[model samples]
Target: MRFMWLPIVESVRMYLQSLPEIAETYEVDLIGNLPKGGGSSIEIDWEAERGAAETVNTTGAVAVHLLIKHRTDDTDIWRAFREQYRIQNLILQEIRRLHDYILTNLKIAVKISATGVEPLGDMVRPYYGNELILVFEWKGAIRDGRYES
Candidate 1:
Protein backbone atom coordinates (compact mmCIF):
# COMPACT_ATOMS: atom_id res chain seq x y z
CA MET A 1 0.00 0.00 0.00
CA ARG A 2 1.04 3.58 -0.55
CA PHE A 3 2.18 5.67 2.38
CA MET A 4 -0.48 7.85 3.89
CA TRP A 5 0.08 11.12 5.66
CA LEU A 6 -2.06 12.85 8.27
CA PRO A 7 -1.24 16.30 9.53
CA ILE A 8 -3.25 16.03 12.73
CA VAL A 9 -1.68 12.70 13.54
CA GLU A 10 1.71 14.13 12.78
CA SER A 11 1.04 16.91 15.24
CA VAL A 12 0.17 14.32 17.84
CA ARG A 13 3.38 12.46 17.03
CA MET A 14 5.42 15.60 17.45
CA TYR A 15 3.77 16.11 20.82
CA LEU A 16 4.89 12.68 21.96
CA GLN A 17 8.36 13.04 20.47
CA SER A 18 8.90 16.33 22.25
CA LEU A 19 8.47 14.74 25.66
CA PRO A 20 11.86 14.89 27.37
CA GLU A 21 11.67 11.48 28.93
CA ILE A 22 10.60 9.87 25.69
CA ALA A 23 13.11 11.75 23.55
CA GLU A 24 15.93 10.96 25.95
CA THR A 25 15.41 7.26 25.38
CA TYR A 26 15.06 7.18 21.58
CA GLU A 27 13.83 9.19 18.63
CA VAL A 28 10.07 9.11 19.23
CA ASP A 29 8.40 7.29 16.35
CA LEU A 30 4.68 7.60 15.73
CA ILE A 31 3.61 4.18 14.55
CA GLY A 32 0.32 5.53 13.30
CA ASN A 33 -1.59 2.86 11.39
CA LEU A 34 1.58 1.07 10.32
CA PRO A 35 2.76 -2.22 11.76
CA LYS A 36 5.41 -2.15 14.49
CA GLY A 37 8.95 -3.35 13.84
CA GLY A 38 12.58 -2.27 14.14
CA GLY A 39 14.70 -2.90 17.22
CA SER A 40 13.78 -0.88 20.28
CA SER A 41 11.32 1.82 19.29
CA ILE A 42 9.09 4.23 21.21
CA GLU A 43 5.79 4.87 19.49
CA ILE A 44 2.47 6.60 20.09
CA ASP A 45 -0.71 5.22 18.55
CA TRP A 46 -4.25 6.36 19.23
CA GLU A 47 -7.74 5.62 17.98
CA ALA A 48 -11.26 6.80 18.61
CA GLU A 49 -12.71 4.48 21.22
CA ARG A 50 -16.10 4.84 19.60
CA GLY A 51 -17.83 6.45 16.69
CA ALA A 52 -19.57 9.77 17.11
CA ALA A 53 -22.57 11.24 15.33
CA GLU A 54 -22.43 14.49 13.46
CA THR A 55 -23.68 16.71 16.21
CA VAL A 56 -23.04 20.22 17.39
CA ASN A 57 -21.48 19.13 20.66
CA THR A 58 -20.84 15.82 22.34
CA THR A 59 -18.33 13.83 24.36
CA GLY A 60 -15.90 11.39 22.76
CA ALA A 61 -13.27 8.97 23.86
CA VAL A 62 -9.84 8.27 22.48
CA ALA A 63 -7.70 5.33 23.44
CA VAL A 64 -4.03 6.21 23.33
CA HIS A 65 -1.61 3.34 23.27
CA LEU A 66 2.07 3.84 23.95
CA LEU A 67 4.42 1.11 22.84
CA ILE A 68 7.92 0.95 24.28
CA LYS A 69 10.75 -1.50 23.83
CA HIS A 70 14.43 -1.58 24.70
CA ARG A 71 16.84 -4.15 23.48
CA THR A 72 18.73 -5.90 26.28
CA ASP A 73 21.65 -8.31 26.22
CA ASP A 74 20.76 -10.04 29.48
CA THR A 75 19.66 -13.61 28.84
CA ASP A 76 19.07 -15.00 32.32
CA ILE A 77 15.41 -15.48 33.19
CA TRP A 78 15.59 -13.57 36.46
CA ARG A 79 17.62 -10.76 34.95
CA ALA A 80 15.24 -10.47 32.01
CA PHE A 81 12.24 -10.25 34.32
CA ARG A 82 13.94 -7.55 36.32
CA GLU A 83 14.78 -5.67 33.16
CA GLN A 84 11.20 -5.99 31.96
CA TYR A 85 9.97 -4.58 35.27
CA ARG A 86 12.30 -1.65 34.99
CA ILE A 87 11.25 -0.84 31.42
CA GLN A 88 7.59 -1.12 32.36
CA ASN A 89 7.97 1.30 35.22
CA LEU A 90 9.89 3.78 33.11
CA ILE A 91 7.25 3.66 30.39
CA LEU A 92 4.53 4.25 32.94
CA GLN A 93 6.45 7.24 34.21
CA GLU A 94 6.66 8.57 30.67
CA ILE A 95 2.94 8.05 30.21
CA ARG A 96 2.30 10.06 33.34
CA ARG A 97 4.51 12.76 31.97
CA LEU A 98 2.48 12.81 28.74
CA HIS A 99 -0.80 12.93 30.68
CA ASP A 100 0.40 15.93 32.60
CA TYR A 101 1.60 17.54 29.40
CA ILE A 102 -1.78 17.16 27.78
CA LEU A 103 -3.60 18.53 30.79
CA THR A 104 -1.35 21.55 30.95
CA ASN A 105 -1.00 22.25 27.27
CA LEU A 106 -4.05 20.99 25.41
CA LYS A 107 -6.52 23.81 26.00
CA ILE A 108 -9.22 21.99 24.03
CA ALA A 109 -9.87 20.31 27.38
CA VAL A 110 -9.77 16.54 27.62
CA LYS A 111 -10.19 14.49 30.75
CA ILE A 112 -8.01 11.51 31.26
CA SER A 113 -10.38 8.83 32.44
CA ALA A 114 -7.95 5.98 33.12
CA THR A 115 -4.40 4.72 32.68
CA GLY A 116 -2.90 1.24 32.61
CA VAL A 117 0.09 -0.86 31.58
CA GLU A 118 0.43 -4.40 30.29
CA PRO A 119 3.15 -6.68 29.03
CA LEU A 120 3.46 -7.26 25.29
CA GLY A 121 4.90 -10.69 24.94
CA ASP A 122 8.13 -11.47 23.07
CA MET A 123 6.47 -13.44 20.31
CA VAL A 124 5.09 -10.29 18.76
CA ARG A 125 6.22 -9.06 15.36
CA PRO A 126 8.54 -6.48 16.88
CA TYR A 127 10.36 -9.30 18.69
CA TYR A 128 11.30 -7.26 21.71
CA GLY A 129 13.86 -8.05 24.31
CA ASN A 130 11.52 -6.29 26.67
CA GLU A 131 8.15 -4.86 25.77
CA LEU A 132 5.46 -2.87 27.54
CA ILE A 133 2.22 -1.27 26.42
CA LEU A 134 0.88 1.77 28.24
CA VAL A 135 -2.70 2.81 27.78
CA PHE A 136 -4.30 6.18 28.46
CA GLU A 137 -8.00 6.85 28.05
CA TRP A 138 -8.96 10.43 27.30
CA LYS A 139 -12.44 11.84 27.23
CA GLY A 140 -13.27 15.24 25.86
CA ALA A 141 -16.08 17.31 24.46
CA ILE A 142 -16.16 17.28 20.67
CA ARG A 143 -17.79 19.83 18.45
CA ASP A 144 -18.85 18.53 15.07
CA GLY A 145 -21.09 19.68 12.23
CA ARG A 146 -23.14 22.86 12.08
CA TYR A 147 -26.35 23.62 13.86
CA GLU A 148 -29.26 23.70 11.47
CA SER A 149 -32.44 25.74 11.72
Candidate 2:
Protein backbone atom coordinates (compact mmCIF):
# COMPACT_ATOMS: atom_id res chain seq x y z
CA MET A 1 0.00 0.00 0.00
CA ARG A 2 1.49 3.26 -1.19
CA PHE A 3 -0.03 6.58 -0.18
CA MET A 4 1.24 9.66 -1.93
CA TRP A 5 -0.59 12.83 -2.95
CA LEU A 6 2.52 14.61 -4.13
CA PRO A 7 0.74 16.11 -7.14
CA ILE A 8 -1.57 18.18 -4.97
CA VAL A 9 1.13 18.90 -2.45
CA GLU A 10 3.37 20.08 -5.26
CA SER A 11 0.69 22.20 -6.92
CA VAL A 12 -0.18 24.25 -3.82
CA ARG A 13 2.95 26.38 -4.21
CA MET A 14 2.10 27.23 -7.80
CA TYR A 15 -1.60 27.69 -7.14
CA LEU A 16 -1.08 30.13 -4.28
CA GLN A 17 1.55 31.96 -6.28
CA SER A 18 -0.88 32.19 -9.14
CA LEU A 19 -3.25 34.19 -6.99
CA PRO A 20 -1.24 36.92 -5.33
CA GLU A 21 -4.31 38.93 -4.39
CA ILE A 22 -5.64 36.08 -2.25
CA ALA A 23 -2.89 36.63 0.28
CA GLU A 24 -3.13 40.42 0.09
CA THR A 25 -6.90 40.58 0.53
CA TYR A 26 -7.70 38.02 3.20
CA GLU A 27 -5.72 36.35 5.94
CA VAL A 28 -4.56 32.93 4.70
CA ASP A 29 -3.12 30.22 6.90
CA LEU A 30 -1.93 26.92 5.53
CA ILE A 31 -2.80 23.82 7.57
CA GLY A 32 -0.30 21.05 7.30
CA ASN A 33 -1.37 17.47 8.16
CA LEU A 34 -4.96 16.50 8.73
CA PRO A 35 -6.75 17.91 11.75
CA LYS A 36 -9.99 17.12 13.51
CA GLY A 37 -12.30 18.85 11.05
CA GLY A 38 -15.37 17.51 9.29
CA GLY A 39 -15.24 14.73 6.75
CA SER A 40 -11.88 13.68 5.33
CA SER A 41 -10.29 14.91 8.54
CA ILE A 42 -8.52 17.57 6.45
CA GLU A 43 -8.29 21.18 7.44
CA ILE A 44 -7.09 24.23 5.45
CA ASP A 45 -7.31 27.92 6.21
CA TRP A 46 -8.71 30.33 3.61
CA GLU A 47 -10.34 33.72 3.83
CA ALA A 48 -13.07 34.32 1.31
CA GLU A 49 -13.28 37.58 -0.62
CA ARG A 50 -9.68 38.63 -0.55
CA GLY A 51 -9.04 42.08 -2.01
CA ALA A 52 -12.52 42.31 -3.45
CA ALA A 53 -12.88 45.37 -5.69
CA GLU A 54 -16.63 46.22 -5.63
CA THR A 55 -18.64 43.65 -3.79
CA VAL A 56 -22.30 44.10 -4.62
CA ASN A 57 -24.15 43.57 -1.40
CA THR A 58 -27.80 44.39 -1.85
CA THR A 59 -31.16 43.53 -0.28
CA GLY A 60 -32.37 41.42 -3.17
CA ALA A 61 -29.06 39.68 -3.65
CA VAL A 62 -29.35 35.94 -4.31
CA ALA A 63 -26.47 33.68 -3.40
CA VAL A 64 -25.50 30.62 -5.41
CA HIS A 65 -22.93 27.98 -4.57
CA LEU A 66 -20.85 25.84 -6.90
CA LEU A 67 -19.11 22.55 -6.12
CA ILE A 68 -16.81 19.95 -7.64
CA LYS A 69 -15.84 16.69 -5.98
CA HIS A 70 -13.25 14.22 -7.21
CA ARG A 71 -13.44 10.54 -6.22
CA THR A 72 -10.50 8.23 -6.72
CA ASP A 73 -7.83 6.20 -4.99
CA ASP A 74 -4.67 7.30 -3.22
CA THR A 75 -2.28 6.07 -5.85
CA ASP A 76 -4.71 7.10 -8.57
CA ILE A 77 -5.15 10.54 -7.05
CA TRP A 78 -3.12 12.08 -9.84
CA ARG A 79 -5.84 11.35 -12.38
CA ALA A 80 -8.52 13.14 -10.40
CA PHE A 81 -6.19 16.05 -9.76
CA ARG A 82 -5.43 16.39 -13.45
CA GLU A 83 -9.09 17.02 -14.19
CA GLN A 84 -9.26 19.74 -11.54
CA TYR A 85 -5.94 21.26 -12.58
CA ARG A 86 -7.33 22.03 -16.01
CA ILE A 87 -10.51 23.38 -14.51
CA GLN A 88 -8.58 25.64 -12.17
CA ASN A 89 -6.39 26.78 -15.04
CA LEU A 90 -9.43 27.70 -17.03
CA ILE A 91 -10.95 29.49 -14.05
CA LEU A 92 -7.73 31.37 -13.45
CA GLN A 93 -7.50 32.47 -17.05
CA GLU A 94 -11.12 33.54 -17.18
CA ILE A 95 -11.69 34.74 -13.66
CA ARG A 96 -12.57 38.18 -14.94
CA ARG A 97 -14.96 36.55 -17.34
CA LEU A 98 -16.86 34.83 -14.51
CA HIS A 99 -16.87 38.02 -12.50
CA ASP A 100 -18.35 39.92 -15.42
CA TYR A 101 -20.80 37.18 -16.18
CA ILE A 102 -22.06 37.04 -12.60
CA LEU A 103 -22.82 40.72 -12.62
CA THR A 104 -24.46 40.87 -16.04
CA ASN A 105 -25.98 37.43 -16.43
CA LEU A 106 -26.86 36.15 -12.98
CA LYS A 107 -29.34 38.50 -11.45
CA ILE A 108 -29.62 36.71 -8.13
CA ALA A 109 -26.72 36.31 -5.69
CA VAL A 110 -24.02 33.67 -6.37
CA LYS A 111 -21.60 31.73 -4.19
CA ILE A 112 -19.25 28.84 -4.88
CA SER A 113 -18.17 26.10 -2.48
CA ALA A 114 -14.73 24.90 -3.29
CA THR A 115 -14.55 23.15 0.03
CA GLY A 116 -12.38 20.08 -0.37
CA VAL A 117 -12.06 21.19 -3.96
CA GLU A 118 -8.33 21.29 -3.78
CA PRO A 119 -6.40 22.61 -6.72
CA LEU A 120 -5.14 19.07 -6.98
CA GLY A 121 -8.77 17.87 -6.89
CA ASP A 122 -7.88 14.33 -5.89
CA MET A 123 -9.92 11.80 -3.92
CA VAL A 124 -9.40 8.24 -2.62
CA ARG A 125 -7.07 9.47 0.05
CA PRO A 126 -5.02 6.94 1.92
CA TYR A 127 -6.34 6.16 5.37
CA TYR A 128 -2.79 6.09 6.72
CA GLY A 129 -0.87 8.86 4.93
CA ASN A 130 -1.87 12.38 5.81
CA GLU A 131 -1.88 14.03 2.40
CA LEU A 132 -4.69 16.37 1.42
CA ILE A 133 -5.59 19.84 0.21
CA LEU A 134 -8.85 21.76 0.62
CA VAL A 135 -10.20 24.61 -1.52
CA PHE A 136 -13.09 26.82 -0.47
CA GLU A 137 -15.03 29.85 -1.78
CA TRP A 138 -17.86 32.06 -0.53
CA LYS A 139 -21.16 31.70 -2.31
CA GLY A 140 -22.40 35.25 -2.84
CA ALA A 141 -22.27 38.75 -1.45
CA ILE A 142 -25.21 40.28 0.34
CA ARG A 143 -25.88 42.73 3.11
CA ASP A 144 -24.10 42.59 6.44
CA GLY A 145 -26.08 39.46 7.16
CA ARG A 146 -25.20 36.26 5.36
CA TYR A 147 -27.28 35.24 2.37
CA GLU A 148 -29.39 32.15 2.81
CA SER A 149 -32.01 30.68 0.56
Candidate 3:
Protein backbone atom coordinates (compact mmCIF):
# COMPACT_ATOMS: atom_id res chain seq x y z
CA MET A 1 0.00 0.00 0.00
CA ARG A 2 1.12 3.52 -0.78
CA PHE A 3 0.06 6.88 0.59
CA MET A 4 1.81 9.49 -1.44
CA TRP A 5 0.94 13.16 -0.83
CA LEU A 6 3.16 14.85 -3.35
CA PRO A 7 1.00 13.61 -6.19
CA ILE A 8 -1.93 15.60 -4.82
CA VAL A 9 0.18 18.68 -4.31
CA GLU A 10 1.64 18.33 -7.78
CA SER A 11 -1.82 18.03 -9.19
CA VAL A 12 -2.84 21.26 -7.50
CA ARG A 13 0.28 23.05 -8.66
CA MET A 14 -0.30 21.99 -12.21
CA TYR A 15 -3.88 23.12 -12.12
CA LEU A 16 -2.96 26.53 -10.70
CA GLN A 17 -0.12 27.00 -13.15
CA SER A 18 -2.45 26.29 -16.01
CA LEU A 19 -4.94 28.94 -15.06
CA PRO A 20 -4.53 31.84 -17.44
CA GLU A 21 -5.18 34.52 -14.84
CA ILE A 22 -2.93 32.98 -12.21
CA ALA A 23 -0.22 32.19 -14.74
CA GLU A 24 -0.14 35.69 -16.08
CA THR A 25 -0.81 37.48 -12.83
CA TYR A 26 1.14 35.66 -10.14
CA GLU A 27 4.19 33.52 -9.54
CA VAL A 28 2.61 30.47 -7.96
CA ASP A 29 5.22 28.40 -6.14
CA LEU A 30 4.50 25.03 -4.53
CA ILE A 31 6.65 24.05 -1.58
CA GLY A 32 6.54 22.64 1.94
CA ASN A 33 6.26 26.14 3.37
CA LEU A 34 6.49 29.77 2.54
CA PRO A 35 9.92 31.26 2.06
CA LYS A 36 11.17 34.85 2.25
CA GLY A 37 10.26 36.62 -0.93
CA GLY A 38 8.09 39.33 -2.45
CA GLY A 39 5.66 39.77 -5.36
CA SER A 40 2.84 37.24 -5.76
CA SER A 41 3.40 33.60 -4.84
CA ILE A 42 1.67 30.54 -3.45
CA GLU A 43 2.78 27.59 -1.35
CA ILE A 44 0.93 24.36 -0.68
CA ASP A 45 2.00 21.96 2.04
CA TRP A 46 0.64 18.45 2.42
CA GLU A 47 0.32 16.82 5.83
CA ALA A 48 -1.02 13.39 6.75
CA GLU A 49 -0.91 10.80 9.50
CA ARG A 50 -1.71 7.10 9.44
CA GLY A 51 -4.30 5.66 11.74
CA ALA A 52 -4.45 2.23 13.31
CA ALA A 53 -6.26 -0.33 11.25
CA GLU A 54 -9.22 -1.99 12.88
CA THR A 55 -10.53 -5.46 12.10
CA VAL A 56 -11.99 -4.37 8.79
CA ASN A 57 -11.70 -0.63 8.53
CA THR A 58 -8.78 1.69 7.94
CA THR A 59 -8.79 5.43 8.36
CA GLY A 60 -6.53 8.44 8.14
CA ALA A 61 -6.47 12.09 7.24
CA VAL A 62 -4.90 14.21 4.50
CA ALA A 63 -4.53 17.91 4.98
CA VAL A 64 -3.14 20.66 2.83
CA HIS A 65 -2.23 24.20 3.68
CA LEU A 66 -2.38 26.65 0.84
CA LEU A 67 -0.66 29.94 1.51
CA ILE A 68 -0.78 32.88 -0.84
CA LYS A 69 1.33 36.00 -0.49
CA HIS A 70 0.97 39.13 -2.52
CA ARG A 71 3.39 42.00 -2.33
CA THR A 72 4.00 45.25 -4.10
CA ASP A 73 6.67 47.93 -4.12
CA ASP A 74 4.11 50.64 -3.71
CA THR A 75 3.46 51.65 -0.13
CA ASP A 76 0.29 53.62 -0.72
CA ILE A 77 -2.40 52.37 1.64
CA TRP A 78 -5.24 52.59 -0.83
CA ARG A 79 -3.27 50.84 -3.54
CA ALA A 80 -2.07 48.20 -1.15
CA PHE A 81 -5.59 47.57 0.05
CA ARG A 82 -6.82 47.29 -3.50
CA GLU A 83 -4.09 44.85 -4.35
CA GLN A 84 -4.85 42.84 -1.26
CA TYR A 85 -8.49 42.47 -2.15
CA ARG A 86 -7.63 41.57 -5.74
CA ILE A 87 -5.19 38.88 -4.76
CA GLN A 88 -7.49 37.62 -2.07
CA ASN A 89 -10.28 37.18 -4.56
CA LEU A 90 -8.03 35.33 -6.95
CA ILE A 91 -6.78 32.98 -4.26
CA LEU A 92 -10.28 32.29 -3.04
CA GLN A 93 -11.42 31.45 -6.52
CA GLU A 94 -8.59 29.04 -7.02
CA ILE A 95 -9.23 27.37 -3.69
CA ARG A 96 -12.87 26.84 -4.49
CA ARG A 97 -12.05 25.50 -7.92
CA LEU A 98 -9.48 23.06 -6.54
CA HIS A 99 -11.75 21.85 -3.78
CA ASP A 100 -14.65 21.22 -6.09
CA TYR A 101 -12.49 19.33 -8.54
CA ILE A 102 -10.90 17.16 -5.89
CA LEU A 103 -14.20 16.34 -4.24
CA THR A 104 -15.59 15.14 -7.54
CA ASN A 105 -12.57 13.56 -9.16
CA LEU A 106 -10.59 11.61 -6.54
CA LYS A 107 -11.42 7.94 -6.94
CA ILE A 108 -10.85 6.93 -3.36
CA ALA A 109 -13.58 7.18 -0.74
CA VAL A 110 -12.00 10.29 0.73
CA LYS A 111 -14.21 13.02 2.18
CA ILE A 112 -13.50 16.67 2.63
CA SER A 113 -14.16 17.66 6.20
CA ALA A 114 -13.23 21.26 6.94
CA THR A 115 -11.87 24.21 5.03
CA GLY A 116 -10.88 27.71 6.08
CA VAL A 117 -9.12 30.84 4.89
CA GLU A 118 -7.58 33.62 6.89
CA PRO A 119 -5.16 36.48 6.53
CA LEU A 120 -1.62 35.57 7.47
CA GLY A 121 -0.82 38.91 9.07
CA ASP A 122 0.15 42.53 8.51
CA MET A 123 3.88 42.52 9.00
CA VAL A 124 5.63 42.73 5.68
CA ARG A 125 5.52 46.05 3.90
CA PRO A 126 3.00 46.31 1.13
CA TYR A 127 2.41 42.61 1.49
CA TYR A 128 -0.63 40.55 2.30
CA GLY A 129 -0.99 36.81 2.68
CA ASN A 130 -3.85 34.41 3.18
CA GLU A 131 -3.80 30.83 4.45
CA LEU A 132 -6.23 28.20 3.21
CA ILE A 133 -6.55 24.88 4.97
CA LEU A 134 -8.21 21.77 3.58
CA VAL A 135 -8.74 18.52 5.42
CA PHE A 136 -9.72 15.19 3.91
CA GLU A 137 -10.49 11.99 5.76
CA TRP A 138 -10.44 8.53 4.28
CA LYS A 139 -12.36 5.55 5.64
CA GLY A 140 -11.99 2.39 3.69
CA ALA A 141 -11.77 -1.37 3.96
CA ILE A 142 -8.57 -3.01 5.16
CA ARG A 143 -6.91 -5.45 2.85
CA ASP A 144 -4.24 -7.96 3.89
CA GLY A 145 -3.61 -6.06 7.08
CA ARG A 146 -2.92 -2.91 5.13
CA TYR A 147 -4.77 0.22 4.13
CA GLU A 148 -4.92 1.19 0.46
CA SER A 149 -7.16 4.10 -0.29
Q: TM-score of each candidate?
A: 0.56, 0.28, 0.64
- Kindly indicate the candidate among 2 and 3 with the higher TM-score: 3
Candidate number achieving the greatest lDDT relative to the actual structure: 3
> Which residue pairs of candidate 3 clash?
none
What lDDT would candidate 2 get against the real structure?
0.34
**lDDT at 117, model 1:** 60
Model 1, range 1-149, lDDT digits (tens) per residue? 11111322354466656666555655456654434544455566666544244244333456655565554455555664565566556555555555555445442334443366666665433234433333333334433322112
CA error at residue 137 for candidate 3, angstroms: 2.5
Question: Which pairs of residues clash in candidate 1, taking residues 3 or more apart in a chain or in different chains?
Answer: none
Ranking by TM-score: 3, 1, 2
The TM-score, computed over Cα atoms with residue i paired to residue i, of candidate 2 is: 0.28
Ten contiguous residues with the weakest lDDT in model 2? 1-10
Q: Model 3, range 7-98, lDDT digits (tens) per residue?
A: 55665777678788767756766764445664577777777655543455555676777676667777676776666566556655656566
Better of 1 and 2 by TM-score: 1
Worst 10 residues of 1 by lDDT: 1-10
Which of the predicted structures, 1 or 3, would earn the higher lDDT when compared with the native? 3
Question: Candidate 2 residues 1-149, lDDT tens each?
Answer: 11112222233333443555433322222354323322222223333323234345332211212222323445775665664454445435634444444434333233332333323334335321222323323334443343433
Candidate 2 wrongly placed segments (more than 4 Å): 1-65, 71-75, 106-149
- Clash count list over all predictions: 0, 9, 0
lDDT of each: 0.47, 0.34, 0.63
